[model samples]
Target: MKKNVFFFLLLVSYMAVAQDTTVKKLQAESGRVIQKDPKDTLPKIWRIGGLYNLNLAQGSLRNWAAGGDEFSLTITSILSLFAFYQKDRHSWDNTLDFNFGFLRTTSLGSRKNDDRFDIVSKYGYAISSKWNLSGLFNFRTQFFKGYTYSTNVKTFASAFLSPANILISPGFDYRPNSDLSIFISPVTARWVIVKNDSISAKGFYGVDPGEHSKFELGAFLTANYLKDINKVLTYKGRLDIFSNYRHNPQNVDLFFSNIFSVKLSNVLSASWNLDFIYDDDTRLFGDNGTSPALQVKSLVGVGLLVKFGQGRER
Candidate 1:
């Protein structure tokens, strides 16, 4: 009876030791996995990223009753950069967006159909979890010469920096989540610049005749939102409005943009973008002549896309 009792006690002790050993082994394995995770080494204060896309299209028509170009080709390229920072109670975000495209038709030859360059920066000091004091700056211009190819004649419309815009606003920023932001400013400053001597002399783009720049004080509001609807679909939108107190306060300026992206693969995607603008001072040429009107542009493309850097943290 004494020998049986001692053996039973020894077996119980052995099982306890084995269980402790297994627990220790599991903890060590978990520690190794945690150490190997890349997120543990990634920087939290600064995030940077870039996106580039290239698209091409071609069409050839044989003899058809409906008249069309014999052969046509279009090429477009878009590049964007992002730099964002967050630490303590301070935050800063900056972005640069550029796009250019050209089309070649058998009748019209080669001509530019799209050109845009925009830069935006915002800095904020937190006043609460969802509100902050913010300062915003934006600049917009075009890359190359643009023309109106009406009546089979190419008439020069605009050139680089001929109608650049600069805007600065100090206001309150509201951010309810990582994907949405809103800003409003009661006093905003804006400048319309025409660097081209000929364009400035013609009083193009809201600038006074013979003047290179025009200044205005206004009220401004801006909103931006971005979201991924699913693993393969994404959307982004922005809206901006300004009312000039010194000029036509009733004729407010408007700008709106939207983008949708569908991922087809790791490196290929399809995208659609639309932009609308209405500024009382800016003129658009129509069948009659140049007049202030709402302007709209849209693009659809499927192409290769390259992305880099860490994504936004929630």
Candidate 2:
């Protein structure tokens, strides 16, 4: 009986040791898995930034040989704001651009030379590595009254919101890199607004006579590109095309804009801007009366720029 009891006690001790060994093996495996697992990192969610430029020029001449104006002054300013967000395959970008200029000459007096206000917002959800489902909204208008100067008279041409354009589109976006994007929308809604009664009465900007606004359904395509040519020069451009299905579908509207900025110093820079537009419904008065034509504008200036905020460097 004593030998049997001793053997049973030995068997119980071995069973306890085996159970402890199994538990230690499971703990060691769990520790390895915990060390091998990747940490969950948070994404950078928001980026906000803006650029502002103010340009000034003045000239006073006493019997200039080149026959320029006796006294002239020009002031121009460009301001742009941007807000961008990215989180978990979703992105949103918003931008506001404004430009205004005034020129004073001894011969022509003080007049406004440039005016523009544009807003763009885009949101996207990634569908693939290079493609996204996107929605875009755009609004464009001018600041103040504009006039056409002639030898005899100065005719009122445009005013604030007189030729405002608004566009909303839901589409697919292709973005191969951070510098380029292309968007295509088969169905788009566009509005032309003429808030001024005088301008609306004349059927300006495709609005019917006595109507304040006009709406159209169309297809819209937009392409945007940004590049740093070198350390000192940067280029940004956008092209927009639209075709009105209810109207003359063959006559597509086009808007293209380009801006090149060269940094001369930390605060001083030179910039060149070019804008082109072609709208079939808009009329321009020429020697042969009224006709639709492509419009072009260009500006070049050296200015002081004040930049702020944190964003993707351009």
Candidate 3:
């Protein structure tokens, strides 16, 4: 099934490229969508840009916080590159992105590592001024290493796992107004990994006979708004709701994240994120002496975004 889907995406991409080439050839000969103003007729492209952030925080009991953190830090890098061509009623878009990050926390004088890497691409098909659909594919990985408890033993199987990935996601966007937009994505992601029989008991990577990675569904809903704060600075807010459903354990997890951004200029920006998560099946099989439902939350994290390009305007 995954292989078939991949082939379909390849076919679509090729077809789109072929169509674009033909369109360009015809336009060059007849001067299609030519502008009266010479400045508007030149190819307009927005080059890619990226952002990197190093987050450091210290939480202590004296701070009156519900949770005590023994000094935690995270470093994240996000890069996005896209080129768009607009001619009259039609538009062509291409995007590529990569993100890699690591988080470290000290609990009870012991340090732990959490790392993640993601790569994604999107090709958009514009149907109208207010609507467009896109093809999305992404691959992600989280690694586990070095442990102090028996629980840590289970982590070994997750390490070095090839990766969990999304073959394709067909998504849509709707703009009700110039300043507001909404979007939704229905997607599936799958993975193959090994695990300690004693720990996964049911098998790892959901390969335990009755278990499978099928129907690993996910969805996202987002709201975006922007306000101008100055000639060069603008403020924006994004509210996002995300969820994941895996059939093996019959579980559903949901996340809510809100981000505030301040664009310093075309090439630099800063953001703060507040995220919360809820899990419907945090418990293991047969009560396992663990809670079956769970809720987790986090507050404001500072981050930064930067774009770099040669002879390119961000």
Q: Please give the lDDT score for candidate 1.
A: 0.88
Over 4 Å off, model 2 = 1-40, 150-153
Candidate order by lDDT, decreasing, is 2, 1, 3
The C-alpha TM-scores of every prediction are 0.83, 0.84, 0.52
Which residue pairs does candidate 1 place in steric collision? Answer: none
Candidate 1 per-residue C-alpha lDDT over 26-132 given as tens digits, one digit per residue, 9 for 90 to 100 = 99988884346756765588889878888889999998679899999988888888999989899999989898989999988898878989999999999999999
- Candidate 3: misplaced stretches above 4 Å? 1-40, 56-114, 143-167, 177-181, 185-212, 217-253, 261-271, 279-305, 309-314
lDDT of 1 at 207: 87
Ranking of all candidate structures by their TM-score, best first? 2, 1, 3
Give the alpha-carbon lDDT of every model.
0.88, 0.90, 0.49
TM-score: which candidate is best? Answer: 2
